[model samples]
Target: MATKTSLSSDDWIKAAFRALSSGGVQAIRAEAIARDLKVSKGSFYWHFKDVPDLKAQMLAHWSSQATDAIIAAIEANDGSGREQLRLLVEAATDDRNLAYGGVRTEGAIREWARYDSAAAAALKAVDQRRLAYVAELFERCGFCTAFSRSGANILYGALIGLEALASGELADLRADMLALLAALLQGGDSSQA
Candidate 1:
């Protein structure tokens, strides 16, 4: 059990994410999270000004870890764009990406966005960033601008839909995504096709 003095802001954020994953945004109450963490509410206050502050910090942390960090990791390797695209799909679909306590944090956050404007905005920003990056990868793979954008939209939309599906229902989403990637790459300049 972590004592109040030993708890960090990251601990509070992670606890809040777990609460959000299990029970939605309303479950992210500081007191509830503190109880879950076996710490007092004062510990939460020590790291955040209030619940809203924690919520803001939580969104920022999620964005940094879930989006920015993944992109950075994918870029660190000197693979070709096609290889990077495959890596991106693998990384995105990897259970370790957003799974927390067997729940998809991305799904939870998307659900939270339905009621929270901040969450919705954050989601929109993340989506745009992802789409742009995917499109850039396609461009690097010799796709035209329009084709690259369209491919990014199709691939990203499918990914979001797959994430919403039950795990048992997805026979092999990663393979499906890779198949889609191969098809897109084969199309090779949609305007000419």
Candidate 2:
């Protein structure tokens, strides 16, 4: 039996995030989340105007927690481009997940984006922001503009791929990322074993 408890908006969001993690967009129903949190249906209405409102807020929360916060933390390190790049790699390859939600949640959001224009737009913005920061870090390391963008794409693509595949070999990916970073910083466009 689930006990009824008062849930704040953040609590609802967290429950929603968990739901999103497990079942994609379809799983984010008010009834489902309320049941999961053992809260009343009224509790959800208290937090959000409606389902669309909740979804929009979810996207905003995801964007901030997943991309903005990571970049800010890395920048705050006051490290060189290469160092920041390394940290970024570390952040991506960490054992948890992308940043907020794990691979499944990311995949869920992406899946949702395909059918919803708003989700698509939100995802596009997140991608652009993430790509831009990676490019900036690469440029700070003295890479040419084209190469920086390319490197950002390559790295970002690799992370997305890993998440898509739900691969669990972080240790190997970390090694590969470091090797790739070394090659990249050394004026080589390709990575070697």
Candidate 3:
């Protein structure tokens, strides 16, 4: 039996992240987290009203860090739209770690969103923000409105695909991204060019 002890809300949140990352959202159990933290289940109740509350808190935490932060930084950068778009591609592709979550986290959150209404709504908000950021960058790079929007969709799809491929041996998709970036920057109409 696990010993009863004090556990902070942060501890539960961290455990929730690990659980979600490893086994998807269904793996998040207050009891499991309490055990992992070497505390009584009461520790969890002290921080969260119940499992549903814990799940909501965890999803919000993930969305804020994994989606909002990345989009905000890309939007805030003082560079040309093309430059920002290129940098965003590099940031999303490069092995160089930064103060953000990876594509896998995004994938897991997407899975969570499929079954949870609140998670789905959060996912929609994150997607809208990310698309807007990408569109802004593309527009700044001189692409037309339709081209920018289409480019955002294409780039996002490519990123998710590359992330899945990265789990195998297809090392880096940087070259492909650069090629796409070059074309977009040159005003290659994504629809017909």
Candidate 4:
């Protein structure tokens, strides 16, 4: 046995992320990552105990980044409750292209969850935080608790649907959905002043 060669976690992470995002969670193989980095499997093993270990670390990293965005945006808003919520919704909807616009891990994760409890758990946690954030935004904007919570779910669902559709005929779908959501939040119906 030889001492494992040195390699940065970031390099492995980048390769892993690209593989997952481009293909799916199933595509995240240690051998593939090693190939992507032009390194030996020892390098991946040196950083991660196994594929599951890599998945766990990746999920944790994604959760932190996503949660931080929500927290930071709220902190920076510093305005009326409605205004703050507005900014959050905007931020949540901003740049659909970068936020899994044309592609998504939804289907992949759903399948993986059958055999991968860790991935399932990670997805559930992320979704809870997302729904809670949206619900808070709706509540701050003076909506009733029940309606706000339900609406938050609806809003999130719509976002995901639009993201899926953005890959096909609904190319302009994101813009349309954003406009509709903004209007509703601003207290204007589909047809009103």
TM-score for every candidate vs. truth? 0.89, 0.84, 0.77, 0.76
Please give the CA lDDT of all the candidate structures. Answer: 0.84, 0.79, 0.73, 0.67
Residues 1-193 of candidate 1 have per-residue lDDT tens digits of 6777798788888888888878888998988999999987878888899999999999998888878999999999799999999999988878764424332577889999999999999999999999999999998888888888999999998887776673447547787788988988887655432
Candidate 1: worst-modelled 10 consecutive residues by lDDT: 96-105
> What value does the lDDT take at residue 9 in candidate 4?
67
156 in model 4: Cα distance from truth in Å? 0.3
> What is the per-residue lDDT of model 4 for residues 101-178, given as tens digits with 9 covering 90 to 100?
123544344456667788788778878988887777677667777767777787788766765676455645546566
Question: Better model by lDDT, 2 or 4?
Answer: 2
Report how far residue 32 has shifted in candidate 2, in Å: 0.5
Per-residue lDDT of model 2, residues 43-88, tens digit only: 7888799989999998998898778888888989988998999999
RMSD of 3: 4.1
| lDDT, residue 141, candidate 4 | 66
Stretches off by above 4 angstroms in model 4 are: 1-7, 93-107, 186-193
Q: Would you list the clashing residue pairs of candidate 4?
A: none
Better of 2 and 3 by TM-score: 2
Q: Tell me the RMSD of model 2 versus the true structure.
A: 3.7
lDDT of 4: 0.67
- Model 2 score (lDDT): 0.79
Mark the regions of model 1 whose C-alpha exceeds 4 Å error after superposition: 98-103, 167-171, 189-193
Write down the TM-score for model 2: 0.84
C-alpha RMSD of each candidate structure in angstroms: 2.2, 3.7, 4.1, 4.7
Q: Per-residue alpha-carbon lDDT of model 3 for 1-193, expressed as tens digits?
A: 5333455565677777666766888778988877777787787887899989988887777667656766677768888877788888877676532222344555677788899899899888878888888887777767777888888998887777777676454746677777767765665544432
